[model samples]
Target: MTIYCDESGGLNAGAMTFAAVMLSPQVAADIHARFRSVTGLRGELKGSRISLVERAYLLELFDRAGGRAWVAMARRDTIGGKPGGAVPSDLSVYAALLNLAVGRWLPETGGVCTDVVIDDGRYDPVILGKVREEIQAGLGAWGRASLAESHRSDGVQIADVIANSLFNIAAGSPRAHRIQRIIEPMLASKAIRVAELKDFG
Candidate 1:
């Protein structure tokens, strides 16, 4: 499975949300092509920019296209590492939450190769390179991980919407009610699994 990842919310305040959506690259491209054809969106379909109806439509498209996702959030208060006025770096926090979000999809036994693609806008190339090694080591097999800009990855763009939709509610955005209403159907149907991380290990 190829898992596309993205995150929303500030690492320092409120709640931070991460999404890992599993789909093949070909399927991701086909879905986004439909999105562009229908929505007439010119470029870069970002979560924060899409309207409520558009967001719901895209999510439905995702679900119907056999996409599976895992989204997780952690409130600032619940996140660890506040002793001695120290806080976790953005990379550490992101990696931990990301690992928690996508880790469940990994098979217990090896042999299978899982590919991970994350939004690479945050960290530099050298550091981003490390993610592949860590994931492969953790997998103990032929696992691949890479980072790409959201504008370039259809699956990552989809993940951005998932993360942002939940973040709006988790962070108490004014659109919380509408976002909740939009996502409730999927939550009820279990198409997208949502988890809250109190202990981020």
Candidate 2:
């Protein structure tokens, strides 16, 4: 199995989300090609850049194509500390969420070798390495992980959609209701697992 991961929010006083989309490599490739052909999206399919309708269509395709996602969320009050004092870095919160999502999705025993692909955002190499270590540890030493630019990775783009959709739900955005309606099937079918982290301060 291959896991593609991305994050949304977490930069300031708002909800933060990390989402992982899992699928077999061949299936993922097929879906990516199909999605691009069907949607005719020329550039990177970023969640923020696409419309709600586009988002819905893309997510539905993921559901129909056997892609599964795990979303981990942390509200500002939970991971953010006192206003003036030492606050946890965004990378730390992101790492924690990654750990939670991967740990929940992968089985403890007899799990196949997994590869994790993350969006190469502004993450520092050292922090990313730590996150990789945490995820590998959770996957029992068989997991391999690497970073890629979202523009070049269709799987990571899917993860970006997952993270953004869940972030809207967690933050109670007006679009949450509609987005939830679209993703309800994924939740019902257990294709998506959600986690909300409490105060880590």
Candidate 3:
């Protein structure tokens, strides 16, 4: 299986979300092809750019295609205990959330190997490398781990949608209801795992 990862929001936002979608290679490719054909979307498929109707269609497609996702969320208001308490850096927040989400959704089992692909953003190479090392260490004796860019990955696009949806829900956006409805099936099936962190220090 392959895990495609993407993030929504940032340190300045009300909340941050990291989402990962898991799918077999064949399924991922098939989903990408179907999405393009159905929506006629050119270039990369980003949630922020799509219409509500399109989002619904994509979510339904994911359900029918057996796609699974995991989401990690951190609310800025609840990050620190006090007004001036120590807070974790963005990279730290990401790494911790990622670790928790992966552990829950794709625990290190001596079975099929799982590869991870993350959206190409502004992450520092050193920090990203360290995160990769940590993940591999945690998965020792189960399977090897590697991280790659999602520039040309369709799976990552799917992850982006999940991240954005989770972010909206966490922020209590008006569109949350619609997004939740679209993803309710995944939640009901436990195909979409969520980790909400209150402390990052």
lDDT tens digits by residue: candidate 2, 79-117: 677778777778778878887877777773256788888
lDDT score, candidate 3? 0.77
List candidate 1 segments past 4 Å from native. 80-85, 108-111
Better of 1 and 2 by lDDT: 1
Candidate No. with top lDDT = 1
Model 3 TM-score is 0.89
Q: Candidates ranked by lDDT, best first?
A: 1, 2, 3
Comparing 1 with 2 on TM-score, the higher-scoring candidate is 1
Q: Over the stretch 100-186, how does candidate 3's per-residue lDDT look in tens digits?
A: 767765653336677767665649777777777887777666555565565577788888888888888887777888888877878
Off by over 4 Å in 2: 11-13, 82-87
Which prediction has the highest TM-score against the true structure?
1
Model 1 pairs in collision: none
In TM-score terms, candidate 1 sits at 0.90
Each prediction's TM-score versus the true structure: 0.90, 0.88, 0.89
RMSD of each: 2.2, 2.2, 2.0
- Count backbone overlaps in model 2: 0
Tell me the deviation in Å of residue 138 in model 1: 2.1
